[model samples]
Target: MERRSNKADKFKYLQPVDRAAIALMLVLIVLIGLLIWNGDRTAPRVRNFSWQNQQVGAEDTSFTLNFNRPMDHASVEANLQIDPLLPGKFSWAGRRMAYTLTAPVFYGTNYKVQLQGAKDKSKTESGKENEKLIDPFYGQFSTRDRAFVYIGVEPQEKGRLILYNVTQQKKTVLTPADMAVNDFKIYPEGRKILFSAADWLSQKPGVFEQQLYTVTTGINPLSPGKPETKPEAAGKINLVLDSKNFQNMKFDLSPDGQAIIVQRVNRNKPGEFGLWVIKPGAPPQPLENQPGGDFLITADSGAVAVAQGQGIAILPMTPKAKPLDFLAQYAKVFSFSKDGASAAMLKFNTNYTRSLFLVTNQGVQKELFKTTGSILDAQFDPRSDTLYCLITRLQKGEQDQDQEQPLLATVDLKKAKMTPILALPNQRDIQMSLSQDGLALLFDQLVTEKKLPKTGALTTNDGQAIVNSLLWLLPITPPTEGSKTQQQQPQQLPLPGFRPSWLP
Candidate 1:
């Protein structure tokens, strides 16, 4: 009875303040529960991020990412940043997002990405706001090692194949001083190099007695104070094809390193020049009805493109693949896209002018540029859309033609615009080399006999200019390049060399 009376008195005499306090406590609990629910809805998390393909040679075209909650499309686009700052577009399907690189990513570079200004767009059951700001997300990836090889152009460094480190700014000559290397190509592994060299053992060789040979590009040419213990043994040079039977003059190694295509000139018949495909330890097979000059094997190794009598033709690796006629009117197929889908070609427009066109795989040709300049060389950018060329425009003179300046320009296929990247005067014997990554280019300037310096770094006392190649590098996509408000010139490497090529 007493406990009942106390309980009854506690409820009976309870002030309005007590009742209000109980109501406030209930409301607080409800508010706290609502806050937790809102947090769960607002929190956005990255579920997965990955590359779609692993066979990307130079640069990947696109990538994908997924999140736990729907994202604000505008916010994601505004906040996303790709290191090396590649231009790209973003698309979203539900919680997953895809990014397509507008300009293909540069090869041999590390890319870091961050998504800072993203927000979640989730729904709440109570019809309340479920918006939440996400934490910054980060990821990083690399394309491949940036590597290149160059032919020594100076007198002392003549005919030497040198492996250069683009990042480290160091160099190591890969060939021996005894042999003279004429033309070379790096295998896909970047460790082995296939080259044609003068055969010293030949009985009575021609002017350029070149034979097929390969050497290890990974060997360290220098040792600690002492000479390489066994220089010959350490040098992994193997005789693939000897020059005894045929004059193996020019050659190109396939990207897969499975076979080599050599433009052979028969020693017996002075006029007989043929194309042969040779494999290690296997007899060389001749391609019938194929007359070759400046030939290149396709990226897939399924066909070969040769500059024949009239035009360039794509002859299949097997006869049944059928021949594809390309550039029927052009004299040469200067360069092919990385995937062999497009080509850069040059045709004579008039006696003094040339027309450069970008030809697609489907026989579609687009006139990139037509100018009165002599197109010394033209190449397709790795992306298969842009084109770069080294053009020398004649300012005056009928025969010699006092040139105004050598112009290095890039043609944007999308906009049909020509932008000059460089302008230099009096650069002779210019040859351009683009890295497999398509991030850099190399060329050499000719040092003529009369203009030779007294120091004679690459000159003879007789005032004859035989060896004059000054190597220069122009970085199109440096991994850590800063903003460019003005034009930048290519840096000249102190080492005198030329005919540079990037390794895949």
Candidate 2:
């Protein structure tokens, strides 16, 4: 009956090495089973989420999230929440995800977020999946604090630098009574303003005596509801530099707030224009061979883009001075991206047509749009993939033959779609700027002053023959294609000025 051939009898016939191998296999299988069970019990967690509830630059910021485990793609999207409800799209890569804001968030505003009901891709022993519920992930950051614009209101404010608080919508004048600030830029920290102004002490009619000056902007002087004392009136204005032989025409502040690039004209030798690099507490040095026109400082502060007779050349700020010719074929560069990463170049062809091209950092030119009329100005939007452009389009109506009307258009860089935002019929010297948070757009639309009978020229009320500008603050709300032009009119703030610029 073979009663002795039971389990023990079979094991006794096996070798010691075979028994050891079987035990090792059992241990490996048990370990794997434990790991699977632990994984199923633990829900995915957001290791670090960025770009939420904080002040960011006017440039469009993309949200980045890192996860501890694999997440369900659909579940994560559905569970994500942003409040006050910013519109954005999500891009996922396994445990990492990015969310790009469709429109830039308003400056100095609190933004909140919540991510709930996100489930892991794995299942548990009872066939239950782990669901992660993240509440109020990363807190917010603030954008730049305030912006400065010049107001040339005569008898009172003539080329006066006005600081407008984005959060409170408050205004404070920073220049003295007779300083006559021509052009200015806010420091990155929003504390001080570097401005070029006509020196009242050395004033000579028709002889242009401008000097560099700086005024504090970060002081809080509400003064218990005293209407906020003017910074200039508070003795905050101080002379930074008294020019002896050069006049600072246009200047750009570095994004890092370390240096300044100025387009200076030699007073002794008229028409001799050059570039000056300045660091605070140190004397400025002239950069040789730099053509004087509109200039911009690169983000790294290692180079500057100067509009020269030949074209825009990026001159490196080094001992060995060699410039890289950029966009030499274009007639003008309407604007450069914040970091000098891209530029809006205009090409004037022999056929009498002008086209606007978006030049990237890789030296690739992506033709944005072209027209037979004209492209007055084009600026890259700091926040998102958008552009604020001023163009004159020829009228196609029957009664308006050969008539062209200037219009402010917003172009979405991703879609190449242009939408008219404002009609600039008689708005001359139209200077436009976007706030650091990308939520507000400020533009000065000046109507030419009536020509004097004797002078036969338009003159500013400041006793100078210059165009007086009206400052308009437009809340950037991109409308659809079929929207009426009037619907896009921005909220016109009471601040009027020229050469409007936001703090970094």
What's the TM-score of each model vs. the native?
A: 0.69, 0.70
lDDT of 2 at 99: 90
Q: lDDT by residue for model 1 over 1-504, one digit each (tens)?
A: 999999999988889999899989999999889887655644686777664212234435677779888888887788888878877788889988988876655655667878876887766777765667777688876564566787677555666778877656767777877666766887764657888776334312235466778888663322112234333432478888887767776777777788788777788986887778887677887776557577888767777788877678788654234576555767666777777777777777646678888888786888888887677787776633567788876677568757656888888777767777887546545678776655677777666655543322333223334446677888775322344223457998787776677766
Which candidate number maximizes lDDT?
1
How does residue 246 of candidate 1 score in lDDT?
A: 77
CA lDDT for candidate 2: 0.67
Please state every model's RMSD to the true fold in angstroms. Answer: 11.3, 10.1
* Model 1 alpha-carbon miss at residue 103, Å: 2.6
Instruction: Give the RMSD in angstroms, all C-alphas superposed, for model 1.
Output: 11.3
**lDDT scores of the candidates, listed in order:** 0.69, 0.67
